[model samples]
Structure formats: structure tokens, C-alpha cells
Target: MTDTTEPTALLTAIDLTARDARVRKRHRAELRFRGYGIFSIGVAVAALLWLFTSLAVGGAGAVYTTYIKIDVHLDQTVIDPDATGDAAVFAKASYQSLIRSGLRNHFPGVTGRRDQRALNGLVTLAAPYLLRDIVLDDPALIGTKTGIWILASDEADLIARGKGTKRSTKSRNDGQAAWIAELRSQDRVERRFNWQFFTGGDSREPELAGILVAMIGSVLSLLVCFAVAFPVGVLAAVYLQEFARRTWITTLFEVNINNLAAVPSIIFGLLGLYIFLNVLHLPRSAPLVGGLVLALMTLPTIIIASRAALQSVPESIRDGALAVGASRVQAIFHHVVPIALPGMMTGTILGMARALGETAPLLMIGMVAFIVDVPKSILDPATALPVQIFLWADSPERAFVDKTSAAILVLLGFMVLMNAGAVLIRNRFEVRL
Candidate 1:
């Protein structure tokens, strides 16, 4: 057999040792670099996850609130039962006065003017509505001992929910203990869901801020966005990818679309504010205007994604369809569009999600704040989730911090749902190997 040892393997023992040391030194440096790279990546991912967790926790608290139950004894002796026949008389302040007087029934033993004011703090601004409903449900309720839920004010709610702590008048430990003992013994407090948040209007008081109007506004705006952005974006993409001849016009269009995508969203909002609200004279804060603004912003994303989807459809399939006596339009509509739709939908949803989180443009258009009874049409002034969050964050009251977080959580949840839906659509449409 030929000698198997290579020339490199013929070194003396001392030379081999030096060469081995060099190899070890080189490998050690390489391993340290790789380890450091992995460590940095891990740290970044961990920090991002922690931030998301903190935001969700704080924001969730804003969505729910607490209140207490109180029964008002409404008897004919307190109201003139004869006036119930007339709607005008029944709707008079005298009816609400009966409610204010009912507060005395809750704390029968409490005395002093300040004590009376503190007792009134338990009534919610929505109390008038509750009182009205009871009276309308049955005129007989005016004269009967009716135990109804009267919502508490925001401050009272905060104290009950542990968001607001009571201050002790005395610095002494015993003094603070005595004060706490007195408040707890009073026991005129209870906790119930803060339903008013979803149904009431914006007010200086947090208890009165309701999300219903904003929700309606958002729904209307999204409808407008889908109506305008979807067809336009999809059609432009189809033409560009399927039938457009190679020319300067198409090239120019592509360049513009790319440029538009990078423009600041706020700049688009300002443009919408000027073009739609001021120039067109569309109703300010109306869903129609806000939707159009968002449509412009969403269009570029949809067009780019749709073109990619169309291009992804194989030319071989198109050729086969054509050979089978299919018209170009028929081949595209039947074979291409079906395959591309899933991608198109995902792109559409992503664009919509982006629109949903926008606040600046909505604000510019007057969606900053409005308390409509209920949105009857697109022209109704409204607020959206992001705008509401911004407003709540600026509130001086300490409790609004929780509300700000809650709004953020809801916004984030909606965004997550839309993205998840996109993924599901993508999976359904994607061809498996």
C-alpha cells in the first residue's frame, strides 16, 4: 500500500502542538462571536415581548368600571300621579327632583350639608336616563318604592375600584386607621360593571365617556374605505400585472405608487383635511370624509400587493388556458383572479388595519370628539379608537391613565384579529407542495 500520511501530517511533536494551539485560538474567537450574536437577538426579542405585555395589561383596565345599586322609593306621595297623563309634565325637573330626594333614603342617619353633598356623589350622570326609563316603563313607578341602580360619579367609581385612594386627614398612624375605619363602616359603596363607558357621551368626567359613538363612526369610515379602495386598487393591479403593455406610463405609475407608500400618514391626513373637509365641504368628522382619507392612504398597499399576487400566478397556467380556447379575459378572471384573491384579501386587510390605527387624519377631519345620541348616517360627527386614546391620555384625572390603556388594548386586539384573518386567508389560498 502507498504511504497514506499527507505531507502536512509529517510535522514534529512541537510543531504539531503550536499548529493545534493556533487552530483552537481561531475557533474560540469564532464561537464567541456567534454566541454574542445569538445573545443580542434574544435580548431584543425579550424586551419587545415584555413591552407588549405591559401595554395590554394597562389598557384592559380602561374598558371596565364599577358602580353600586340603590333603590329609590318612588311613591304617589312624592310625585303628582295625575301629571303622569301628560308627557310634558311627566318630563319636568320635578320628576328628577324626586330622584335627588331619593338619595336621603340610602343614608338615612347621615347628617350635615357636606355629608349630603358626599351622598350625591354616588349618583351617575346617567341617573337621569335610568330615572326616565323607569318612569316611562310604568307611570305607577312614580309612586312605588322602586329600588333601581343609580350609577356613581367617576371619582366615586375610582375610589371603589381601587384606582383612587382616600387621603387621611391626620399624619398619625392611629388617625389614619380611625379615618379608614370610619369610611369602611359607612358601607354605602358597591361595585358593578361600568356599562356607561360603551353607551354614554364624552364629558369632563370619565364616567360619562362612552365608546358607542366612536364605534359607530369607525364602522362607517371602514365601510367607505372598503368601497373605494378595494375595487380601484385591485383593478389597477390586474391591469398592470396581466394586460398592460410595457410602456413609460405604467413605469411612471409604478414609481408614483412606491413614492406614495413612503409619504408620512399625517401628511395624508392634512391633505384630506384640506381637500375633503375644507374644499369639498364634506361634514367634518363624518365617516365619509375620514374613510376617503384612509382610502387614499390604503390604496398604494393594496395595489402593490395585488400586482404581486397577479404576477405570482404562473404564465404556464395562462398559456394552457389560452390553448384550451379560453379568451385572455376569461383565463385571467377564471384561473388567475381566484388564485390571487387570497393574497388580495390579505393585502386589503393589512391596509385596513393601518387605517384603523390612524389618529392624526381623523383628528384633522373633526373626528377628534363628538357625542352623538346615535350615528344616523355617515355625516354624523365621531371619534375613533386612536383619537379616543389620545384624548384620554391627556386627561388630568389619574383614572384616565387606565382608560388610555384600555383603548390601546382594544385597538391592538382589533389589529391582531385583522392580521390573523389575513393569515387564514393566505393559508387557504396558498398552494401546498
Candidate 2:
């Protein structure tokens, strides 16, 4: 008691301002945390840059393919002898001989079966199909000399694209190398935009492959997915938020929804196979089945998002509507739902974007089929872009590597567009609350 004044005076001498030890320690901690956050972001961005650069570099040559402009002698003996419009007649003809004759006409110096075969190596196996289709479209070309730009084989295309040539002298069998050298000297080889890569379907020959069919299938599958998932997900969320009481059953249901969101995508595929394909007897590879599977996967996300948006709506707004003689249903449907729509849409788009990139689920349900024809209906057998990418990535042909990269670029573009759309919707409609 006698020394109280002196102790108080000593305590007062200690600084409690911005320069205090505790304050400096807190500032240092904040700086360290900020540095860590920046470092993490930088790492992520660097990884993305590396991936994009590698893909762009590897795939740049793929956008264009090499072709040889050969004057093919469409001999009647080789193509159509009877001069009939029968497709079967065209199908049975030995178009390979006609192609060989065309090559011989171009380079008279090439002789012997080995040299001839090497010369023929300049074009893809699909080259015959191209010739057949051209002849079928205009039957008049059957007996005439025609100039057509035929696609080169994978090896030749690779050489033209400066990747590698099977004809390199380093190979034990370098006969084709000499033939390719002679053709290059003659300027028969040329590079052009690969329109067939966009207009055609999957092919064993990478030069003949395209992404159109997969695109169509993805669109169809997403359409069905949205149609089923959106309304049902929103309805379920609203029912849980507004009508359901705080019961053990409802609590368990909430927990299950949360857990479902974390479940492996392949599990959903198995569920789809069991319920839709096995039990409901839906078409196996059709977009309808794929869409249903996606819907199940997407439902939990949408419901969670929708409920969160619903809860975010001010309780006072509901009270005001109810106080003004509006029913609870009217309050929620008219006022609350509209405010929550933007959030719901944002969530739905995010979920759809996730679905758009999934391959395993699609694979498990048979969307891995090599569908050449563009799908005309939901029931048609189809493959999505992700599945197509997986298929191409697995292909041994070097050209498929480029195709995979280009497809990835396209997929990234699509995903970016979708995310931007989500942002736009959210910004346009999100309430301040």
C-alpha cells in the first residue's frame, strides 16, 4: 500500500502505442501471412502458364496438316467399270491402283514395287475414302484425270509439320525417306488449314479426326442435364429451407447432401449404370443416360447453393410480405426466389462446368464409344469432348498429341466462356444483401 504510487508510475512509463512490441509482432505476422498468400498464388499461376505453353507449342503444328496435290487418273477399270450409280460398285473398286497410277504419272522415275509402295506412303489410308467420296459426289470424275489435294499419312504429315519422318535415313528401312526427299524437291507437298479436323469425325488416322461430333454430344448432354437438374434442385432446396422443420430426419438428409457433394464422380457413374442403364433400360451411350448421371452429380451442388442463397435473403423481407397479407409461399416465390436466382444460377453454371470436364463418369457409362456420326437426338449414341480427349490422348499416333492439345484449348475456351457467363449473371442479379 505504501509503494502503490511508485509501482503505478513505473507501469505508466511502458509504451502502448503503435510502436509497442505486441503491435510490431502482429504487423510482422500479417506481412508473413500476406507473403505466403502471394507466393501460393504465384505458384498456381506459374503452373498454369507452363501447361498452356507446353500444349500450345506441341499442338501448334496440328492446326494445319500436310497434303499432296496429285493428279489422279480415275481409270474406269480401277473405279467403276459398269458406269452405274451403285454405291456397292464404287465400294468394291480397287481405288489403290488408281492412286498408284496417279503417283506414277507425277514421278515417272519412281519404279519397282518397293519404290512404288514408298511413294504411296505419302497419303493416309483415309485418302482412298476421300477419293471415293469425291467420285461418288460427282460420278463424272470416275473416268477422268482429276487434281485433288489428298491428305498425307501420319508419318508424311509429321515430316511436313517438321516433327519427324519415318523415312529418316536413320531407320533400318529408309526407302520412304528417299521418296519423301524427291517429293519435297518437286513441291508436291503443301500445308493447309485442316478443315476436315473440324468437320470430320474420329478416325484411326489422326489426320482425318475432328471434334464436331463430340461437341454436338456435349451440348445435347448438357441440355438434358440442365433441364432435369435446375428445376428439381431449386425445388428441393426451397422445400428444405422454407417448409421442412428442424427434425432428425431433415438433419440427416442435409448431412447426406453434403456428403454426396464430396463423393467420387466414378461412384455416380456406377449409380447411373445401375439405375438408368440396368434398371430403367435407358440407351447405354445416349446423352440422355449421360445427362441423368450428370444431373445426379450436379443436384447436390445446386441444392446447397440454392439453400445458401435462400438463407441469405433477409428474414425481414419475408416478415414484411407476410405482414402485408401476402402468404408465405407468395413471399418466398415472388421476393426471395428472385433475389436468390442469381446465386442459384452461379452455382448451377459452376456445377455444369465441372460436369463438362468429367471423363471417368462418361467412360463408365459407355460414352467412350467411337461415334463418327453426329448425334441427331438425345437417344443417339454419343461421346462428349472430355471422352474424346481421353480417347485421342490414348492414341499412339503422334498427330493425336496435337489433336489432344487443340481439344484441350477448345475445352478451356468453353470453360472460360461458361465461367464468365456465371460471373455476368451473378453481377447483374445479385442483391446487395
- As a whole number from 0 to 100, the lDDT of residue 274 in candidate 1 is 92
Query: Mind sharing the TM-score for model 1?
Result: 0.82
- What is residue 393's positional error in candidate 1, in angstroms? 1.8
In terms of lDDT, model 1 sits at 0.75
Best by lDDT: 2
Model 1 Cα lDDT, one tens digit per residue, 1-433: 2365554456566688898999999999999999999999999999978977888776555565654555666656445556546655655535466666776665576567765555665566667766776676777666567666566666555655554433311222232233223444665454556676677656676766766776677778888998999999999999988899989998999999989988888888999999997799999878899899999999999999999888888888898889999999999998888888898999999999999999888887888865646677888877788888888888887667777776677678788988998999899877642
Q: Which pairs of residues collide in candidate 1?
A: 59-405, 59-406, 67-192, 71-147, 74-143, 74-144, 75-143, 76-143, 124-151
lDDT of candidate 2?
0.85
Lowest lDDT sum, 10 consecutive residues, model 1, at 167-176
Superposed on all Cα atoms, model 1 deviates from the true structure by an RMSD in Å of 4.4
Best by TM-score: 2
RMSD of every prediction: 4.4, 3.9
Task: Put down candidate 2 lDDT per residue, 190-277, tens digits, no spaces.
Answer: 8888887778778887888888888888888888999999999999999999989999999999999999999999999999999999
